[model samples]
Target chain A: MDLLLILFETGFWAATVRMATPLLFGTLGELICERAGVLNLGIEGIMAAGCMAGWTWVYFGGDLWTGVLFAAFVGACFGLLHAIFTVHLGLSQHVTGLGITMLGAALSSFVFRMLLPNITTPPKIIPFAPVKIPVLSDIPVVGEILFRQSPMTMLALVAVVAVAYVLKKTPAGLALCMTGENPSAVESQGLSVFAIRTTAVVIGSAFMAVGGAFLTLSAFDAFYIGMVNGRGWICIALVVFASWNPGKALVGTLIFAAFDALQMRVQQQTAVALPYQFYLMMPYIFSIVALIVMSRRSAYPKALLVPFRKGER
Target chain B: MRLEPRAHTSMAMTILVPVGAAALALMSCSVLILWAGASPFLALTLLVKGSLGSVFALSETLTRTIPLIFTGLAAAVAFRAKLWNIGAEGQFYLGACAATWLGTGAIDLPPPLLIPLLFAAGAIAGGLWLLGPTLLKTRLAVDEVVTTLLLNFVVLLFVNWLVFGPWKDPMAMGWPQAEPVVDAALLPPLVAKTRLHGGLLIAVFAAVLFWVVMKYTTWGYEIRAVGNNQAGATFAGIPIDRVVIRTALLSGGIAGCAGVSELLGVKGYLTLDLSPGFGYSGIVVAMLAGLHPLGVLLSALFIAALSIGADSMSRALNISNYIADIATAISLLAVLAGMMLTRYRIRFR
Candidate 1:
């Protein structure tokens, strides 16, 4: 019933992974964008759009995987819109990103309401089912914590590995890093920095949308206004805590999710005297602490928010 | 397409671009109107008429514009100095809470004295709220964007805790809201029945004051200097950190004022839905105004009109009021691109 006891529960870590799946997708998505020198402030709205897109797709008689893909596609379109402004037009990243967030969030909600204006209760969809990783899920407590989850969670795990592998060991990723560090150098290398940053933002946005889709398509059954809440912003902070590294992002996400999941369970404890709102505040408070802790050491991409103009530099 | 800086921006381009951009944005959104089974033209008519057709409608839009102006000024000020204070929404709430705490039977004074005192308290609360994020950015190189944004959630949840717990009004039959402020603390109504109140004067005064300060003052010069080119400002002996911190306080104070204005002038009590994303929409207003202080006033009204109009349009057409949000966002982005077009010419090769 105490906080410590809640941390030891197998259910706690399992929920932690489920929660982390979205943060992981978001953090990794943000990580990818920041790594390539573009800050996708559109994560929140992109996730919202993804949530609606995936739910609508599933609601309209599509398979879950394809629904996720549709969500990613919706996310990618927004990413493309963001890229057109920030990446290509070289507009202010902060303002442009915020604009995209608004567009994504509002448009999705508008579409949702337009689709179901009269439904008093939000319609639910049958979501992705839990799938155990055959051998891995059969092991000790660790297996139960890490392997038995919805397919979306497994995709999140695979995404982290794929992101790490590509970022650390691929030609494309090297170009991305180069773009973030010294775009002039990247341009001199006969590569299009615009294309690279655009791709990163698009892919990162897609990942963020998938992270959002995981919520409605797996964790929960219906999309609600503000359900994504501040998860996307928290991931933005996690990116800082992780120092823009994919592997570290995974660790950071789990820690965040563990704290998040623990707060939920702790809130249920009758002995706890604090209001539940304080428990809800745990993730945001943790984000700020994480930011303060990592601020000094966090080495952000040099050109992260810097605009790239061809031949000008 | 590649872009090249224009040697001189023509006045016509400056005027045409924003108009063209807004038109394009609205045109793009007609698809949604059509899908909603309403004519885009009719929806547009409903929107304009709902927001501005009558004195009553105009008063309502003006009521909504008050907070937008305060929040818009907050964003315009901070963004001018290169501080990204996205937590205006949170600061607004904190301001509201601070005002509520003091105004709800805790303090009573004559209207002339009490209103100013509450505004001052709210500004201080909002300013102090942003101090942490600003200091982090200046001292430790933390990004203000994420920290400020995260704090917004924390502040809201804190408010949620307050309304549902200690601050819950026992007199209000089962509503999760604070006790209403003393009558003396409330802003005098400008109209008999409409929500319009003296907040309009304060908001307009604030806007004009900001415009003058930003355009003429030495501190304003420092803020603009630091924002335009930090390294150059550093070379010129401007204290970049101090300016940024000062900007944070002022920006946050303005946003905080929005909370007090809403709490006193309109709602008369603190509730979870007091500002209704006024902080986020403030960014849109600031952007639409091209970060100009006086421009914020115009843009706030413009945005208020859009929202007010959309509300009526949605009610009539069975559409969503979120369309107005879509319109504002589209305009922000389009204007961003349009502003760039004035400075740079795009050529496809």
Candidate 2:
């Protein structure tokens, strides 16, 4: 009975919130970008840039919110760079995204080394305190799991709803969808496809940056090299798994997060003595399997990877 | 916008285009240096000297080039078939794992047999690793690019798990690494004292073999046809799906060889961060090489030189080694833009 209690309290559900935070931020950001028809493969780089930028800013006496904003700004900058290459210069999105990622990785490492010169210890920061809801504080497990969390969690939920509203309900959202689906048709209807896409990419990148910042400011307080790890790529996969829906993205992110959390929680008790590498492989393995299965049933945007050209369908 | 049949001028222009693009790339790097308050000329000179002037630096550059060559060939092969296999890094790690596992206890043959068997194991492991993504892509119309990239993370985590868990060096204090391979398993030195090893030969041999197969084989011809125009190839009765799978598997296999080389030749043991983005760098090399085997060879060397030089420049100038990366990005952009110019003349409206 005690062991069962430990399993219940320490299993997947208990670890979901912590694991889900980064994925939530990343997937939501990627969802927005993909819906806008700009597949930003540079999400990994953007996230890394955000991680370093957020960590650096927060470490140097800056407010956590300020660090988040700075990370978003950095992501926006990368988005702009991506936009210039893909939209303006008409470069291949894959190549441009890879280049941006390389640049981001190099820049992150360089800046981290330059700013945080030779410290034996990883720098620590006071992370965001989990906020308990006044009315729900007394409630059992559900309330504690749902309500007692950092502001970022609530913000992620709000962002998802807002994104769903913007993509499905608003006129601008309609135009954005039209641009992604058929830019020439949208243009014929007097909409600016380039403007829509550029804005989407920038805003989408900002979300990714914020997500990266959350990883640093809320999840771990310090940044390590490759700290964003594969979260950025995971976000990209989530976009596909969600079938380009923000709400679906949330579900996918949560599921993935739960798995990750379970892996962490069960590390001590699992008698299989499987290498931690096997555990680390779980999320990625799940993601690929999820993508393969989902792609069979999911409906991707019609013009997902196609670059739009003016006066050409 | 149709080109006139001016064959001679076009040929001459094609020959000179890369040179012009290189010049433009240099200018861009110089501008970046100026932004950093450094002299471009001095930086360029130092970069050149740092990469090639010293024997140690030259060997290091070659060492870096070894894995890149395999990854570049891997990307080039897959891209030629329009397969979009983006998990070469993951495949490389898998290959290394297989090689390590085999070298550890599975094989106890002589040096020649053991080494070749290890390479074969690495290749098979890499090929198997990509099988699922290829199947998903061909059978279900799923994008291999996304799946492959995701698998990379999974492979990386697997490496981490190994280093931190079962494979953790029993003798080491706390470092996440496996026990060093037996002396007989280590790659023989190429130049006796220098860091250079026989891995460079393997990379070159792979490139040559790929070039021959791509140029001569009927399968290669079909792959190129499908990549160029799937509908046309299908109409012409080419087995498009089969070709795609074959190319993807071959690419994965080649990338796997890179893992073996790195493990046996350079690193000698697996670690979490074994690759300093060699898989990613392969994308740049493949692109810069225009997906040609010969081009991949040259581009890999140039990239290796730049990476080596970047480190040296850092030591000499106290500037960040990342300047080399910035240089690579600018060069890639310039070269890509130059290729575009060769195909289409841009006209402002």
Candidate 3:
């Protein structure tokens, strides 16, 4: 009974929160980018860059906020680089995104080594302390999980709400949506498709960087090699699972986070007799299965991966 | 709104383009070396010497090239059929897993019997792994690129699970790896003392066989036709859907050979980090080779030389090992940009 209780409570719920945090940030970024009609496959690389940048900044300066801001700035720079390739240079979006990812990975490792040479121990920052809302702290299990997260979680929640509002209610959001769905139509209305996409790319990438920064600054506080650990890719999958809706993406991210958390929890107590590798494989396998099922019913943006050229309908 | 047609560059100019791009790439790579506080000239010399200076270096380079050759061929085959198989890394991992399972659990045969069975198992595992994405592309009209790339993470996680969970060596301490396979299951050494093995021969043979099929086989012609134009091929009575599926599966299977090479040739055991982006590097190789099987062989060798030489340069000159990766990236960018010169002439208005 104690073993079962440990498996159900701490293993499942705590793991879920830990797993969900990075995915939440990543998927939200992807959701915004895809909704704008430019698929940023460079999320993986960008997140890694953010992890290194954020960790390095916090390590030296001892300011987590500054680290996050620097990460966002770095992400925006890469976003501009991606925009140059896809928007101005007329390169394939997929190829450009892949190049950006490679560049990000290369740059991260290069910078990490240069900054922290001959370091026997990895430097760690004091992670953000969890905040409990006054009234919300009195609530049940939901309140504990939702309100008792670090400031980054609160930032993520705020960003989701803000993103959903902008995507649905704002004129800029409509223009961005039009640019993604039908660039020619958007352009015909005398709006700059390039401007809308560039903005979307920059903003979307900032979110991804923040997600990465959160990993280093808030979650673990020490950046390791390949620290993003496929969370950027997980975000992409979540975007698809959510049907490109920020709200749905939140749910999707949580589900995946829950799976990850459960896997960790199960490994702790279960004598399931099977190789633990099978359990570790659960989240990825589940994501693929989710993708396969979602692909059967989901509706993607019409011009998702297509680069828009002027006067080409 | 009218534009004048530009004159086509001469054949000599076209040839010079790649050479010029390569020179530019070299200059760009020098910047990285300079940043690392190493003399560009010294670094380049060390790189070349480390890759090809001695018989041992050459053997090491060949050992590195073996898996790349398979992955490059895999990417090339899929690209030729216009079905992007970005999940070559995952397929490679799955292949390694299957080979490990067969070599350790299922097969108890002699060296001759076991080796072939392991290779076969690896290929079939890779092929089956690719089947889901291919089906999605053909039946659901889903994009294969995203699906294949996504599957890579899934396979990576699965491989991690295996090594860390069930396949953890029973006798060994807490290091996350499987037990090394029996001597009967290992690939025979190609050289006297070096790490080079029979996998290089398999890679060469696979490349040559692919080249022949692509040049002479009817199916190959159909595949190229479909890649050139799906509608045109369909109208011409080619089995377009079947060709896509077959090509994807074939690519996945060939890529799986990389797993076999790694397991039997290099590490002699399965670990989580078995691949250092061999699948992704295959993209650069495929692009550099212009999707040609024979060209993939050469590109794979070049890339392998760079990787091996990079390590040597790091040891000899104290340059960061990443300088080599930067060089490879620059070369890939240059080659890809150089290929553009074949189709379009850049002009300033």
Name the top DockQ candidate.
1
Per-residue lDDT of candidate 3, residues B1-349 (tens digit): 2122346657775556555655676688788778878898998888889999999999999999999999999989998888888899998998898888888756688988988888888999999889888998899776677778877877887778778877888766888888888888999998999999999999999999999988899978988998999899989999999998888878999989899889998888889889989998887777777788898887898889988988998887665576666666666666655665665555556
Q: After TM-score superposition, what is the CA distance of residue B60 in candidate 3 from its true location, in Å?
A: 1.3
What DockQ does model 3 achieve?
0.38
Count of clashes, each model: 0, 1, 4
Docking class of 1: high
Per-residue alpha-carbon lDDT of model 1 for A64-128, expressed as tens digits? 99999999999999899889889989998998989999999998898888888778899999998
- TM-scores for chain B, in order? 0.98, 0.94, 0.94
Over the stretch B253-345, how does candidate 2's per-residue lDDT look in tens digits?
998999999999988888877787777778778877878887789889888998898787777766777777766766666666666666656
Alpha-carbon runs more than 4 Å astray in model 2 = A1-15, A136-142, A271-273, B1-40, B104-114, B163-176, B179-186
Compute the lDDT of residue A23 as modeled in candidate 3: 81
State the TM-score for model 1: 0.98
RMSD of 3: 3.3
- Which scores greater on TM-score, model 1 or model 2? 1
For residue A63, give model 1's deviation from the true position in Å: 0.9
lDDT of 1: 0.91
Q: Write out the backbone clash pairs for model 3.
A: A275-B166, A276-B166, A277-B161, A277-B162
